[model samples]
Target: MPVLDLTDLPAACPPGTAWLGLDLGEKTIGVAASDTSRMIASPLTLIRKTKFTDDAQALFRLMDERKVSALIVGLPLNMDGSEGPRAQSCRAFARNLDRIRPVNVAFQDERLSTSAVERFLIEDLDLNRKRRAGVIDRTAAAWILQGALDRLRP
Candidate 1:
């Protein structure tokens, strides 16, 4: 399936399945998942970047295990809400991900998502640098997913 507009995800969502969230970084892909009710999101895992085929297969396996049918991928937009190179890369990932198998994907504006996650970690969790580095990506993925879920809620 081609990537759908972000707003189209809820309507296109299939029953009895959950949504997966992705925060794509240069070296890793952060992952999160929504509840079947689509109300809450939790950080799931991280996928270290490797071959595209390897990454896709790992992601697909997680989706299969978790009954996930759609992806809400973070779109790193400029502060002015413009698509930049990073955003374009995410769009490409979505397109390429679809080629392996059918997957509905949508972009959620991810301005400051990583920084916001960092702030929360520092202020609330107070985790040390190494610990923060270990969990930041997946935690950011949860933040991204929660933002989408909040907006998508009726």
Candidate 2:
């Protein structure tokens, strides 16, 4: 499937399949997966950047293993609500993934997602710097996925 608008995602999914969320950073791609009921999102893994093919292969492997039915990729929009290079890069990545897999892909505005997750890890969870760094990306992926899931709730 092609990339979809946020408004179109809920209707696009097949029943009983989960959604996967991605936070595509320069150095790593954070991943999160939803439950079969599409209610909860949990941090799954972080894939270190290599080649695009490698990244896509790893993601597809996860999708196959997890029975994911859709994808939600973070769009790092500027504070002014404009697309930047990073957002374009994410779009490009989504496009590439779509070419390889027949899965619904959508973008979620990810303003301050990382900061929010980091603050939660530091202030709420009392994680140290190293621990925070190790898990921040996957946690951010969960944050992005949760935001989408909240919107999907009726």
The most accurate candidate by lDDT is: 2
lDDT of 1 by residue, 3-114 (tens): 8876788788887689999999999999999999888989999999999999999999999999897999999999998899999999999988888788999888889999
Question: 51-151 in candidate 2: lDDT tens per residue?
Answer: 99999999999999988888999999999999999999999898887787677899999999999999999999999998999999999999999999988
TM-score of 2: 0.97
* TM, every model: 0.97, 0.97
lDDT of each: 0.91, 0.92
Off by over 4 Å in 1: none
Model 2: runs farther than 4 Å from truth? none
Note the clash tally of each candidate.
Answer: 0, 0
